[model samples]
Target chain A: MPQELFNKPVTELSGMLARGEVSAVELMRSVAERTRKVEPKVHAFNSLDEEDALAQAAASDARRAAAKASGAEVHALEGIPIGIKDVISVAGQPLTASSRMLATFVSPYDATVTTKLKAAGAICWGRLNLDEFAMGSSTENSAFGVTSNPYDLERVPGGSSGGSAASVAAGEAIASLGSDTGGSIRQPAALCNIVGLKPSYGRVSRYGLIAFASSLDQIGPFARSVDDAATVLGAISGHDRRDSTSLRMEVPDYRRGMDELRKSGRKWRLGIPKEYFGEGLDPEVGAAVQAAIAEYTKLGCEVREVSLPHTKYAVGAYYIIATAECSSNLARFDGVRYGHRSKDATDALDLYFKSRAEGFGPEVKRRIILGTYVLSSGYYDAYYLRAQKVRTLIRRDFLEAYKQVDAIVTPTSPTPAFRKGEKAANPLAMYLNDIYTIGVNLAGLPGISIPCGFTGGGLPIGLQIIGQPFKETELLAVARSYEERNDWRNRFPTL
Target chain B: MPKPEDFNLDHVANLARINLTAEEKTRFSSQLGDVLTYIAQLNEVNVDGVEPTAHAFPVVNVWADDVAEAGLPVEDALRNAPEKRDNMFVVPKVVE
Candidate 1:
């Protein structure tokens, strides 16, 4: 099958729309057709309404037409169709987070990210699948259906943003939005052979995103090219009063930053974190990432080895803090207000217990129990409080390294996408898949995963770039420098 | 690895408001035991005198204007309620 108009990058599509070459309705119809063709094999979307998408596309067309007649400016994403992870609310759409607890829950209002995307003229089309309540590393934990890797149907797409990555890899949408708590966006992007960025904590608003781990969760973009990701990030990022955690910083035009870095001819100091390359990393992935580093050197970027000494403790601290926050965040699904209710309940307490037990999935239940146990009277100081302190150490490690190097590079994941059910039986093994990416979240810094190369069996390898706090422009610039040197972004799965 | 026998699954389940079956309890007990064993490495870090970070950024007391805003309508608010009556979510009686 030929690549449809929907598979073009948002930049190209924007130019085409401006040049009167393609109507928004035509572009939307092509995407709808592509979704119908690829959905069965990849299972990327949770819910999609073609009628609603076309109506939105038509509205965008009318706005553009009026702008043209009045000689006014149109938004950057005037008619681009994007897939949204179900965790982010789009008003009037199902916000399930792939859990039965919100299986029938329709969002009453748009999330901050969704509102900004709509305001910038982006069409938030379908509800993408995710790990149930964004707890698991794989989408197999979703109650809806597991999203298959577009590269290989038998293997898992690295999650909990599996559907977000799979949709773009399968060319079902032009671009997509995903939330990363612990490598949710980057890991899946690497597995699917695409670009994914996790902006600095508080860089984007989180008002309408169904909270998993509040402090670490950030909504970002996934695209086939670095420019599209930058464009989308610029559109959705800014200060919002609704979320107190949102940063009070000015949003820069990130696409311009990418172009500026491409021409600056400046040598950036890149750090290779030695801890990330040792022991469990697959040999093929290490070699590919090392080669990517060499390409950076050839592009006049200085490379040196730097140590994030507390890297090992990152997973430990992340699990403790994330689960603790998740336990408190998800407590609202008690059947008193909305979501699934139990029929066997005799009293309020029974209703709470039965409704939660029936509504939550196994992984969610396990996290809730673990979180509750850690925060229990005797364990709080030893577990929850101790983890928080170690989290501070992890953040300090990154800060120390940033003084010596402009950015740190590591393999996004230890290995390529694993076969379905390979690590599902052991939760610890699944958690270790995020060993390389979780430290970025712990430090609350920006990180981007761009495809570097492929394995012998053709699975994609991702090289991650970690930046200083609120330095997404520099992060995306470094990513684009490496991106422009290779054709890796052009490769897509023939699903 | 921490001994799975040391943690009582039933007690924790009670605190979490989940009524797990015997099979689920056994499964979770062993799996969570593995995870807890892995996370036990945090004890090795020397975090003395470090202030615990609850939020990523430091923004204290972010106050908004007190003007009343148009909020979710009664119909939209109760749209997803499992049980509702008279435009309000209905729950079991808490008091006798």
Candidate 2:
């Protein structure tokens, strides 16, 4: 049986395009048709421009033809379709961060990642929905509307990159880009039963990513396979002069590196952090992760127990630091320059208050208020400063464990996708969804979540692999080892 | 550390430049109190001389060359402005 082009991975699609098996236009139409079929049910995209996507595909076909005629090399991602999270800017596209704040705004310049993707000859697909300002664990916080989990419409897809994950799982996209502040990318990928990678901070440029906890946020990929993720990562992982924080380091050919590592037959030292397996983790999710570890041992890998003592404080520390950064970064959305402007204001001061109150959703307002309180006079040291110091402790904990382990393994999320609105009313409960993944952001390390198995209820379970800083190549290789041995990556939601 | 009960919601809303309805104030005051109480657990960590980490891998003093390059055109720069006049964003009256 022939696989549907819409559901095929990037590696397969790229190969077909190179071999003249399919034109880029046909591939785009297949994906666009799939998106139209599933988007009404999944609501994965905030908006899409299929016409524009087809045009880009036509251009890719032309480029490939020219390359074939001249015997020139074509880029790895040529003719592939990739979705963009709403928070990342794509010039001439709607830049709504799933919020009314920028509901009417359009970007005038491409994000660094967007530019790189286009340069690699990929068609930038749609503006995928997210939690407004990427603040919540579920897409319920989005002002646009909730994006349903492709696996189960009643449950959330996990957020704030929920749509990014759901689209790929539903065959609406071949691959997608998402930004992880806490666990936006990995958590959603876990729930959707896909592969998501959060690159180490500074490893990827954040030039056009809407600031959300700037110190921790990193743009990453969500794909059907680890190999697909490596291809996307290689295109977007280089340093940019526009973003000073981007690391000035050499970008390796991650796909080639994965092959090299596999050929070397090297076994990795895997760490199982005891803190991640404690109370509150769903029993099935724990069993799946543990089974994955056992598989690693069978593959001749060394499995060890390591402790990250400061793990308990990750969520609390994350909220303080992330909110503080958000409150400051979001100040740019005032009515004066861009975003929503108040029609009910009496003066400038009144405009600021009314515009923000009207523009922001409840979660955004709650975070802004909390952030302002923490950074306010007399409370800065007690809250913000204290959290930063605690952050230091969290990073040290990962470093300490890294000395004994090549990579750490844990459940990507505590539970499978929960029913929509289950933890919506309580912010603290929602924040706990990122408990296992947030420490990686604090420690500035790369982490990848790969589908390990499914729950008895048929929901997916993800196994997270934490890698050393600036070591995504090794991380993807480690994740591929399990992926190659498992059939989980082959399954997709029947949308 | 200040008690979570002592959190001044109205004052914080004012600082954040966001208006809250009476209902919102009441709801948020209680909810945020729970979050703050949870955060109070940070005091349990012994950080006698530990330094704070603003960024996990800090890159200090990044300098670009003293050179000129094209920037966003005025038209593009003001493209998203809610209200604009002659390529400048228009805002509410400030001076009397």
Clashes of each: 0, 0
Clashing residue pairs in candidate 2, if any? none
Please identify model 2 stretches exceeding 4 Å from their true place.
Answer: none
Q: Candidate 1: TM-score?
A: 0.98
Question: For candidate 2, what is the total of clashing residue pairs?
Answer: 0
Q: lDDT, candidate 2, residue A283? A: 98
lDDT of 2 by residue, A139-248 (tens): 89999999999999999999999999999999999999999999999999999999999999998899989997899999999999999999999999988989989989
Give the Å error, residue A217, model 2: 0.7
Interface RMSD of 1: 1.9
Kindly give the stretch of ten consecutive residues in candidate 2 chain B with the minimal lDDT sum.
B1-10
